[model samples]
Target: MNENKIPEKYTYIILTFTLISIISCIILNAFLFYGFMASIIFSIYLCRKSGFSIIELFNMIKRGLYECKSLFILMALIGAMIPIWMSSGVVPTMLYYGLKYMKGTNFLFSAFILTSVVSIFMGTAFGTISSVGIALLALSKIFGIPNYILLGAIVSGAFIADKSSPISNLFNLTLETVKIAYKEAITSMLKTLLPTCFISASVYYFIGKKYSVVIENSNINNFMYAINSNFTVSPLILLLPLSIIIMLFLGIKMLKSVFLALIAGIVVSIVFQREGFNHIINAILNGYNINTNFVQLNTVLVSGGMISMISVLLIIAGAVSLSSIFQETGLIIPVIKRITSKIKSSEELILKTGLISGALTIISDQSVGIILPGKFLINKYKELKVKNCILARTMADTGTIIAPLIPWNVNSLFIFITTGISTISYAPYAVLCYVSPIITFIFAFLHKFQGRKQTKEIQVKNTIK
Candidate 1:
């Protein structure tokens, strides 16, 4: 075996053991802490056996800290905003109108697009799935739509938004990891995502064509009546978060964007809610609690307060820390090198990277698995004269699009927890998740639209120049 590479037998043993540890963590629902500690321990053990020292480990840890500091801060700020935004009724208002709209159209396509928009707004698949996804499941039950199709649409939409959202941690992480400009990353991602989204919407439209369940106008009237009676709904209230998005589009820092949004939320809640400053303060400290006659609307409104986000924030922090340690141990590098060495051509490189990313989302987390491999593979692609846009597009297509299919991944777990749906049942209908990888692979081999010169042509051009 090469000194840098783990022996194949040992690699298998290590992967098996690590997998067992991960499964245990998931079974115990200790995904945040114990899973993190396990990763750290595994990395340290591997490094020690490879003759790395404690001092080197510490240095690597420091480097990881430096690398992830901005992202960590951004995550914290976004977490803080979740509660305030919730309490201010901004998210609820959005959901209320969103659900109202879904009362008419093809529920599958509507669910997908609505959830996609909400997830992009919320900056997380988990948030979108937990809130809107749960509501969609309930609606499916009420309207007699098949749960599998509803679940599939929800998963597809949330992940697509999560992959594309500028505020999303995964999106931010990818931009940073690839050292690409945010606009550049977004632009590159849209090349693949836009087409996939159109195809996904078309598929959903067809899948839902046979079922026409008209929600009684009385039922829709009652829901709307309940929403109007229970809470204050104002379009102006939305401007706060909308401004934050505008800032993001204008290239403002994510932390600043979230911080401003949180402040805006606080101001809006203090001014708009029935209770005065006292209630606002209590809600911020505890969480928003809305008592209403309409049970469904009550469930929708009574979310998002400071305390509500603590659990998620802690989970994210732990997950990011574990990812940091993984980066530090040189384990990821050796693994990356090993994987890339087997690729014989540019097309093989794209396909293998997409496959590896999709596979790792099953074992490891989504963004880490995808972007880590993506960052590693980029240089190899460049050597083959592949365009950077193609690499970025492929990453989004495979990474963002595939997460919900993995039973153990965060997106799938959140959906399962919130909707009480099986990953296996929903996986087949998550059209974008499966289709994106295939599309990327097809483009890579066909070189039909990648916008890059072939390796030989590039070499010849350089020689002539």
Candidate 2:
């Protein structure tokens, strides 16, 4: 006879133990690295108790890493690409033109849209925050807009492309985890993204009416001048981001696209900006560095390198190991099945997925937040006839977007460090973060009605026959 399976209650204990371990690190302000390690240890204990041998557990981890091997390589390429783009003047050039064309009338509205554009190009929240976000906050002081409200809009826009951008690590991770195609993921997410952006833009416009300040171009001009002085500003640099996007849409692999872009950046840095070959090599290894008289501009221009990706890689490895253990031991299946048994409709499923994602994001940072929920809930989504694109979109809608809203989360902490404002202070006004989930759920409800309508049409045709 087969051996008896573990009780359902054991699943609960495992999940609770894992969450507590991770949450403790956040509470104590310890590195999340320690938290992941603790979770890994506890998960190993659970796996062993369930009769998994050490070698079997190792194989599980190896299998998970194999699945994620592409993501690791892409992340490292992004790491190298960022510094090259910075040193090659691609980032600075974009910043120059973005600030030059930024609307000064509806300052709040302008801040949201402009930051969204920059974030789309930069493909990371922290980088966008440190660069355009810093400059926008400085302008907010001049326009007399509240720092909190402006920061809220900035943060909102900074994350718009987290799920949609081709170069975004978060986007790729969600895509890779769900095994969805790039085209499908983008198409699915846009359904929610377009509406949220419109609503957010309108809200900011109306709010701008509450505060009146004349548009002063001098402050903006100074920023442009500072950027222009540091590096060459040209339309040719636009080719770097454009090339990656073009190749991605044409079905080129993400790794090849990013790698090609890195090569292009190197050439641009050498031929256009005239950066020394040694300086370029150093940037790829360590990170780009620069010194300038403009203190504000100096901070934004420097960052990125392969070395900067080590911590992220380590965290991903640990999380993947933990996820593998859960999969191998079969502990999480019973838990997911039990919870999903109560889910009656597609809308309910989407709602619960969002809630789970939000909870995970609260307990862990963005990476683990997306990783765990995607792993656990994907099967239920398939059972419900839901497309994996929706699963990817939901995780991005809830976990990835809501991350910076939490005060102690890593993304929030980085925002605090960069902007010197508390997360709670600005979170209320981060319209996109709040709007995305609402819009997504609204779409879910609409999807349900559409499904019902289709079923009725099929029934009518059958009766006529």
Candidate 3:
């Protein structure tokens, strides 16, 4: 038997496993990590039922983990970085100033914008929500803003950069799989991105102002005082964020840039915040905690460290292992062939991709969101003369943005655990999440305009030849 491809017979079992995962995670409100782990167990049971030897199964596990080691390492470092930066006063400083600037209609609007900025830089939705996202959530609470509005704003904002940021792993993966240049892909995507972002933000401005809470000057002063006392706040600390962007400019890879940023935060904490070497280490290994006596201040000003990310890491480890099974079973190749058989037009393929993207994210994780559906449809786009950029855009709209809308997706769970808001509770307010698909399909039909033009140009060029 060819080891690379699983026979068509196994497809039924695979579909069943996915169905169980979806129902458990969605309907029953089970944690994503546990649901994923259960799927891993189901996969192993299938291996055993097939009478596979112990050695073969073990090898599959190793291969899967090997594929995701870099991702896990990035999460670990980010986990450590968050805490180190928090103790170093980076998060507190950002919060202190962000609160000062974000008022009234700008509060929710700023949440979306601020998370967008940080997620673009961090390249992880979870990190953005855990760090600065945490601070913004707290501020919304202080202003007596409704959690639904804040949740929607923060989630929508956090994914903006995660989907499009050059450093984003998912974005990079989409480019590699779709066989498009980053410049070419992003240029095409910007056409859809600009309009959607503007409309989403405009609608949010009203929603934000509607929920805006009036705070007394005394309350603001006390809030600022609590943060200032915990960490030595100043403009100089802004260097940490600036340097990270500079590192990216210097061609330093994101993983290394994150490590360097972590070290920089530690140094700043030691020099300015008076964090001793031991305390810094503790925070990195465990988590950073600062108590400001006031309950609101204490809640907002604390969090970070490597251990904080362990649960989500486990979920990814489980998800990646299952992804490997799908690969080794050789299901992907046949799956793609079958999908390509029925799709006759670019419009049909694009619309189907948009639908599959959300379903994949719900059944699997963010990576699976793109890998499963995109790979299935990749070659079809080429045959139909659809720009690969259209494929990438569809994936971003459905897969990337939909992650936080489902409680079972790792990204959404991370946000919920960090901010204590359920995905269902805030999904309506997450205008961008739902709005993206609308714009994506609208442009999908409009794409025929550009497609016709390109096709005509190609035909003329071929006639000349």
Candidate 4:
């Protein structure tokens, strides 16, 4: 207690306690939010033991929640937008066109590509998987493709912009933590991501071919008809989703775009879908539900509303509180400091940074993961003459996408709860998520891991050649 430094003994006790708590939660099939809440209580007790007063604990938790306020706002807005869009026919209409165009063997491949685009505009992997990703899986189910492959494709694509989109909070958090320019950070990540995207596309293409099935025109008609009877489908409602993309590209912030889209969806739902004010109000509060002759279509078509985000909000709150306590107690610092001391070569540095950063990532939010690593390692990177951009990119390569692989992590938990795909089954096919670290590691070995714009570009070009 006198050290105020979180001595080695306390460190082991905290680590052991956290590990056991998480493992016990997993074995019990507990909701991850509960685990986070438990972790927070444990941290509070630890903080009190380590010379913190009740007032100080309250302030620390408040400060942590304040940092996460923007994310909390964006998530609530997203929750509001989902049901509005669904009732407006925005979602079903998109699915109709997607199915119409991306027919047969191309559907699975298209699902992968489309989810990437949707994830960027949606600005969260959870939103992409819950809305459009659900539709894609329904389409694949109708076509008789194995759920595992299509589910894998959906999860993989949903993560495409978890760390690169102009409007993504995770992307912003990474840049802020690494102290890099948005343009530069995006450019660096794209360099590593683009190759993986191309490779994953090819992989999905081949795999899709093996299981592709053709639906008769009648089946397509029935699909559209089911949606039509439930919600009025229109091309005009399409503008809402498209505006989100345009607004993001124009440098408008994500929440503003979400507001714009939400209003648009409301207007369309009222006018075209013949929705009453009460119906729209219900949609905003409770979400949209549509019933159809087919149970599968029923599952896919029903979604959205502000209320659905309650559990997610709770998880975020708990995660942030847990992260705040870690920051306050100096618990994470000693572990990171120890890792920093072991760095020898640039490759090991990059590899270990990725591994350590990734391991920490699943246990916390993206902000906490990158902030801790960047705090502990940026100076070392400077000593090694590596660019800070490489540090940012390496963090994403290891830490960013792997969140969805950890079944207990919030990202994976939301994906599993929404999509019903077990993490273990879909992880192997989340090609880009796993491929990214491998790509970064290869870049490290080739000595192409600098953030220097020109030199790193030249090295990467040569390595690619």
Which candidate has the highest lDDT of all?
Answer: 2
Each candidate: how many clashes?
1, 0, 3, 0
In angstroms, the error of model 3 at 18 is 3.5
**Ten contiguous residues minimizing lDDT sum, candidate 3:** 1-10
Local distance difference test, each candidate: 0.66, 0.77, 0.74, 0.76
Candidate 1 stretches with Cα past 4 Å from truth are: 1-12, 27-32, 58-86, 99-102, 114-155, 161-191, 207-214, 304-314, 359-376, 382-385, 404-430, 448-465
The true-versus-predicted C-alpha distance at residue 76 of model 3, in Å, is: 2.5
lDDT (10s digit) by residue, model 1, range 375-451: 67778877877666666667778866787886655556445544557677899998888878777787787773444
Tens digits of per-residue lDDT, candidate 3, 212-277, equal 556433277778888877778997897886676667656686678778888888889899999889
Poorest lDDT segment (10 consecutive residues) of candidate 4: 1-10
Q: How far is candidate 4 from the true structure (C-alpha RMSD, Å)?
A: 4.8
Tens-digit lDDT track for model 4 on 50-143? 7777787778789999977876787777677777767788778877876677665467787898888888776777667755776676677667
TM-score of 4: 0.87
Give the top-scoring candidate (TM-score): 4
Ranking by TM-score: 4, 3, 1, 2
lDDT winner between 3 and 4, please give it: 4
Instruction: Candidate 4: list runs displaced more than 4 Å.
Output: 1-4, 118-127, 146-148, 182-187, 214-218, 292-296, 416-425, 448-465
